[model samples]
Target chain A: MMPDHTIPPSNIASSAARTVFFVSDGTGITAETFGHSVLTQFELRFRQIRLPFIDSIDKAHDAARKINEAYTNDGKRPIVFSTLVKHDLSSIIRQSNGMHMDLIKTFVDPLEQELGVKSTHTIGRSHNVVDSEEYKNRIEAINFSLAHDDGQSHKSLSTADVILVGVSRSGKTPTSLYLAMQYGLKTANYPLIPEDFERGKLPSALPLFKSKIFGLSITAERLSEIRNERMPGSKYASIANCRYEVNEAELMMRREGIRWLSSTAKSIEEIATTILQEIKS
Target chain B: MMPDHTIPPSNIASSAARTVFFVSDGTGITAETFGHSVLTQFELRFRQIRLPFIDSIDKAHDAARKINEAYTNDGKRPIVFSTLVKHDLSSIIRQSNGMHMDLIKTFVDPLEQELGVKSTHTIGRSHNVVDSEEYKNRIEAINFSLAHDDGQSHKSLSTADVILVGVSRSGKTPTSLYLAMQYGLKTANYPLIPEDFERGKLPSALPLFKSKIFGLSITAERLSEIRNERMPGSKYASIANCRYEVNEAELMMRREGIRWLSSTAKSIEEIATTILQEIKS
Candidate 1:
């Protein structure tokens, strides 16, 4: 294996070419995964310099140095697709005056603007876990409602691009990715929070993707089984809680006109095909 | 958050209910990615438990323990899908009296038998590198010619499932995974090794999935660029050695009736979609 520095530098300073730097504090592999998909939604010519394996601020500087060298020879403003979690890549990017996106900011800013709350912080891969007291409370309530899942109650409604209003522990994430993987449909899933049932309203995001949405409901017992694997000490893992959430979410999805499915018994392939069929119909 | 221990033992003890295990020592996620596809093609029912982060003999034992528990209640023999480069789980598995297969053995066994070689005792992920003295000697007298990629040769191939068949750093792995996650396909690739080219054989496994194979050829210059990223100073990273290997592999693939695409000057997406179309048709 040759060292990265030994490769002769490309003429990155060519005025006509634009740099699309994919930046991240973790391995830039995921950004490349998501960014590659996002890039296809555009037609701009760009180069991909994956700045992977960043775990600290100083490492961020090292990654930034490589990007700077790439830009030194390339005249166009670079379009950066960044997943920088550290505090300084923003400054490095800003200083470059390039066309760049800060991904953490993109996800966080919109979420804050839409929900009016700052996200709770987490270390490493669990960073996406809910961090705020309010959101945490809402998540708990949702977790509570998902405990009472009843299968057929939420069956006949249709108003979601990809409805993922499911009980806690239902197979939603894998199914959503499968739908996207096997088909090109835009998918969004919302856990049917307990508040949604109490207030008799769908979570806001579901409504936005409603016309093409489809719900994912699961059996109470199965929900208990899956949740038991994640955090067993809590009441959330109790069968009774799982039963409550399932019934409530099913009822809420039913009342709100969001079509749903019983994911507990369905295979991932089946869930994906079902969603594809519902959307196509 | 759920607890892993609470999974109820399967009550179905009939032969039809036997659970198969798919295990890998490194990134069981990738191994299962391929394993699940194969399992889906068969009628057998199986359970999937990834044992990634298996760094030592103890870790392998721990994985075997979990796998044993999963199969403990079943009446039929457990069929294991396993890929292990080291840290053998063989002894632990043998104790369980279930039918388990190590993938490397399953794949390499037949090749060894047919080639009549007792095996040169190779190690690790650099499966096809010509760094070995034996490999160098083997290729010296052989010349199976194919097309040499000129860094700009990806324009005309119309049917590509993301053409990727190359030596390491020839940019095949990242490019293929990008295509799969970006453009869904039943994509398959075969690396062009010195052995394959020297013997003028398509490494028998490929012919089984031939229609889906797309060769990923790279420019000698570009390959040196990538090779340098890992080893700064070595014969392997030398531009002259790279040029020789690239020309040899490309010529071998073309002459032996395998089609290919270049990874020298294309963005990840271009390489992805172009080859995607090739294999799609």
Candidate 2:
């Protein structure tokens, strides 16, 4: 008998290909981050594709139509990786005969069985976060062993391989932690308080680390979205304060010759990868 | 002109044609995370293999020997995907007749060119973090945000999609925020204080959110490693204290039938992904 010298693959089954629709109800950037990372992990060993995020159910239908057409033409039963809102597009996917990666359903299954409660799945952001179980990482980071000093001016700038400086709500912390996790970097970030911009100088400790310092700035509106959670109903929540802080911070960063990127529209993954490009460039 | 009938090939090369090495200095997992993700993105395009990790030059030499042998056998230039201490592996890789993805070098290239300072690429964790602009995210999580309110009994768990209960340094906040970012979940986490565990009960608000309650526990050593940074030369840093805290937390988690995981040996990615699995499950 011939020895069946088949290459045993990882858990990812290529034949029973898994289609994960990493849909975002909005721009799909968040969906892309989680969805893409997971996809990247399995794509090499599996058949995987991503849908360019569509904003509405109609657009999702159109995309699904194209996908259905493609598989029909190929005479192959390709899995539909739609990151669409499951409720909005479930019927369409079911009828299309394409195996749709309904993350919501996958998430809801174990939750309902173990917990004995059917998830409304309508809890908006809170419900969505809970559904995906993404809270552990944040909780972990809050408690993760961090070798960072946000308040001490990051005095060891000379020893710093890279330093990040950004205004409040610029998506600095998550990005830094990501770089640290992905690239194993000892990332230290300094927040550009209004006083620093008003004084129009880089944090004093940053000069020596100037070569390694990278600035993070976000659009006032985006910053507001992130900050309103913390300081609701304050001048800080006012678009005016946000705008001033953003504009002043950018000018200060420019004056200090600190290279920076806008964290406004970019996902954390994109921000981290872009910074990696800078590090690798 | 020929009609563009072909799909852009999923990957540039085939797996059997490439000699891939998952290399790192400390643990092999960190290197594998980046190496595997990037490689996976290509869709099985290259002929690949992994060399777990090489600590000593002798191991490097032995691994190089096998890689060269494979290259000779395949009659193709192998690509070595590597992450290692800069001081150790350059010569070894250069000695090999193939392409090598030098993650550290890839990470350092942009820094040297832009900053006008040749990166030593020799710093500790700082080297990995600071070389890239990923510091912004890490800093923001620390430099900004609300205060930790562990003792508040009537805390606003009502708004939380999920509540994380654990001891200090058990990774609650980052996980919570990550859940919110990735899945749009509103996560609230509360640490399991000694008093709560002593009573053999979880936190007050946790039972209400039993379906979404999660726990994170770390090993005594890693917990101490993290605690030492905050309050060095104290009982908090002592292994004994770490053991006590861990034992108590684990006991309470089991007694209460609360789902929990060990954060000691896992990377942030592993931990985060695991939590996502549990919650989704």
All DockQ scores: 0.01, 0.04
lDDT of 2 by residue, A100-216 (tens): 444445333443453243444331232233222223333333333134535444444454556778877687666666655444455677788888876778777777767777888
Against the true structure, whose lDDT is highest? 2
Docking class of 1: incorrect
Error at B149, model 1, angstroms: 33
Instruction: Report, to 2 decimal places, the DockQ of model 1.
Output: 0.01
Interface RMSD of each: 22.4, 22.9
Roughly what TM-score does model 2 have, to 2 decimal places? Answer: 0.50
Q: Per-prediction TM-score of chain B?
A: 0.41, 0.48
List, residue by residue over B139-197, the lDDT tens digit for candidate 2.
33233222223423445555555566778877665555554444434456688777876
